[model samples]
Target: MALILRDIAVARGGVPVLEGVSARIETGQALILRGPNGIGKTSLLRAVAGLQPLLEGTVEPDTGQMAYGAHADGIKAQMSVAENLRFWAGLHGTSDIDAALTAFSLDGLAGRLAATLSAGQKRRVGLARLLVTGRPIWLLDEPTVSLDTASTALFGQAVDAHLRRGGTALIATHVGCGIDAPVLDLAPYKAKPRDLAGFGGNGGFA
Candidate 1:
């Protein structure tokens, strides 16, 4: 299964953000969205995840089962660490909290308030949601945000494992995460005037 984009275009605040961008990510590979700030890296990710409205174009993945994690970690501050994971997994109808926390090194903090965790700790908790839910495609925005070298390495290992298991991922990051994947920059594709009715790209590799 693959995710394909065809002649996609997007506009925000009445300005074109991405135009004619095209790429196809497959079942066992990863794709990186690289660009300067305001070039629509995050916007592109959101569009791919179906979280944002596309002005023009299309996003078609061979399958609909997916995972999307943003830079914010999206952990609820008022909830316990495990409680937060429970809430996220609940969205996917998952009930295995122990295994989920264990996989992310979060079992020890199960009862700890997520608000009391450090920035790096919180990022782990957020990433754990993806693992626990067991989605096939992962759309991650800055998966290593606020992490130290060790934490970053841990995150890297997790992603590597995910790829090894044939889970596709689309990641947006300014800082490199030691994972090897094909890269796509939006600017070159966006230089031309666009229709901005939707966003997508068409690409093929043989």
Candidate 2:
């Protein structure tokens, strides 16, 4: 599945942030989003994921084909590592989670409760959820936040495998995920001050 965005505008806190943004991410490819903080990278991803509405333009297909991962881990503190993966897998109509555990190197910690794991360990578990989603497109924001050097590499490998399996990803990150993907810098798309001032704050429309 190809993810396409055309002349899209996104907002944050009811203020216009990015406009005139366009990009096409095809299957088996990853596009890295880059920009300074508060430049609407997160807002753009949210718009793409359908968590928020687009002020203009369109995103091809619907959110059903996409899986979004944000800064929040979305893990249940009470569930064990294996149990968590099982929960997501079931939601996506998948039953096998062994591959996901191996991809993030979580095999050893599978039985441990999420609350008992360290930050990096929990991060790996969080990322591993992507595999169980069964969706072709991944919209991730700062996925490597609490990861260590080695853990980051593990994530990169998971992305590599995802691409090989014909999945697409749009990732917002400062550090590299070690994938040979093109970068889409959001700097040029920064919404002009004039544009922000004119927004009616009626959910980013007009």
Candidate 3:
């Protein structure tokens, strides 16, 4: 399995959030985590990416082979588009950044600082980082949030290509994301809404 989460359980300050979450995502597949606001969608993605600990589960990943893009974009405002790619490319041990910059329509923004670009442009910069990782598993949280229609399509195309190349993905987003992937809704697995910080006591969405 490219990514696997089994018997996953999470609690915050003694309140349960997710329970008995299990899934296996193999190469050439995508898993879409769809849920209302809060309800641990982002938390689940974070845990899968090893950013957050799994309270009661196991996540086995192929080391140095994943990219995590959060809803916030995680772009450095002071750096230009090319500059940002250069930094991440270097960090990921990549020797090329030009192809990534061009893929995200950032060639023209190479001279402009990230702070000066619009939200969509910043998102492109953030997504461009994926090109440097060369990882097979991509963990994306609301990756299309700040993107325009064109950019969203562009991102989707990138994902499709990745899947074609035997890559895997786990995405957390409310929208369809327009990718072919199994969707796991936390609503049913989460017995009660009030079990977590983001869920109401009635097992209702946040």
Candidate 4:
């Protein structure tokens, strides 16, 4: 199924971050989200992944086929590289770990503890989990962070393969990951400030 986001308004702590954002991504296509910091790119990704509440509008996708990878690597430091991948694969009801390891060039570090890997290596391992998730839609937030040039190219290849297999990706990145995709600039959708009297607690705005 394709992902359709229409007139979406997103907020963080009751303060709006993105307003009137609309985009559509068909299967086998990639949509690269572009905007400066604090423009609500991450919020939009989270909204699509069902991790954040949408203040307005709708997103149509088969929830069961969606996967989200945020700024955090989500890898356990105490676990081995392969162990971490296997854990995620099992969680997603899959066991094909070899493909993921090979996809990210993680085969060599499969037995290495995550605690000892370099930043780029860890990022690679984190991205590899997407392959084993068996999901068709990827919501990636700053996915290329800390990746070296070679690793970045590897990541791009993985996305290319995914799209070729009829999977869709909504990527939020500040750097070019080499994916030739349509750009979805979130700048025009930036939220205007509103009265915060009703917003409880911090009322933090992105």
Candidate 5:
């Protein structure tokens, strides 16, 4: 499936950050989002994921077919690694988590409680959830945070496999995930100061 964005506008803390943004990420492809911090990369992903509304424009085919991975690990601290994957799998109407575990090299840590794992290990578990989601489009924000070089490579491989299976991804990261996709710089799309006129300084909206 192709994920299309038509002149979208996104905001941060209710204040417009990016506007007139657009992109078409076709099946089996990934698009990298590059920009300075607070430039609305996360906000754009949030808007695409339907976690927040768009300030203007549209994201095609709805967000039900998309899975989002934000900065937070989104793993349960009390659950074991395998248990965490299983939980997400169940929510997304899937049960097989073995592939997800192996993808991120979590087989050895599968039985360990999430709280006992190191930062990188938790990050792996968090990212592995994307696999079991059964959603074709991934909206990830700084997915490699706290990951070592090796783990980052593992993530790249997983993304490669997803693309091979006709999945699409939109990732925002400072470091590369080793994928051979094109980059979409958000700098030119920065919202102008005049665009904030009616927002009232309290931000804009929740």
Candidate 6:
């Protein structure tokens, strides 16, 4: 199975952001969305995840089985690391909390309160939720944020494992994440007129 996007148009806050974008993410592969800020990378990811409406075109992924990770960690302060994972696992009808914890190096911090963990730790816990969700498609936005070198490697390995099992991922980030995936630069799909006019031909509004 694959996640397919056909000439889709994405918007944010009712304003058009990206237009005429098409991509196909085959099984066991990852597609990285790269571009400057405000270029609609997040909006595109949101559209594919079914969290936002597409102004036009079609998304043919089994969106019902997709898991999305946004910029926030999404951990409740009152919840323990394990509790947080269990909550999502239950939501996804899964019981893979142990595997999730081990993947993100959170096995030792399972009993720690989410609020007490460092930024990197919290991010790890947030990422671990993806594994427990048991979803084949991962739509991640800035997933490596706050991750140190070692933690970043852990995240990459987790992604690699997911792909090995016939999973697919679409990642939006400014920095590369060590995944040997084709880079889809969102700049080319940016909405016309305003994007060119607002940026003064330099692709940035300065």
Clashes of each: 12, 0, 5, 0, 0, 0
Candidate 1, poorest ten consecutive residues by summed lDDT: 197-206
- Candidate 5 vs. true structure, TM-score: 0.94
Report residue 63 deviation for candidate 2 (angstroms).
Answer: 0.6
Top-down TM-score ranking: 2, 5, 4, 6, 3, 1
TM for candidate 1 is: 0.87
Tens digit of lDDT per residue, candidate 5, span 102-140?
A: 999999998999999999999999999999999999999
Roughly what TM-score does model 6 have, to 2 decimal places? 0.92
Worst lDDT window (10 residues) for model 6? 197-206
For residue 86, model 6's alpha carbon misses the true position, in angstroms, by: 0.4
Off by over 4 Å in 2: 195-204
Worst 10 residues of 2 by lDDT: 196-205
List where candidate 3 sits over 4 angstroms from the true fold: 12-14, 191-206
Q: Estimate each model's TM-score.
A: 0.87, 0.95, 0.87, 0.93, 0.94, 0.92
lDDT of 1 by residue, 53-171 (tens): 66666788733577888878888999999888889878888878786676678878999998899988998899888887778888889888888888787777788788788887888
Which prediction has the highest TM-score against the true structure?
Answer: 2
Tens digits of per-residue lDDT for model 6, 1-206: 58899888776776678888899999999999999999998888888888876667788865887999999999999999999999999998987799999999999999999999999999999999999998999999999999999999999999999999999999998997868899999898878755323322112222
Span of 10 residues, lowest total lDDT, candidate 3: 197-206
lDDT of 3 by residue, 1-206 (tens): 37888777665445666777899888898989887775787777776776766666677774457789887877788888888888888887876988787778888888899999998888888988998787889999899987888898888888888898898888988876668778898876664545344433222323
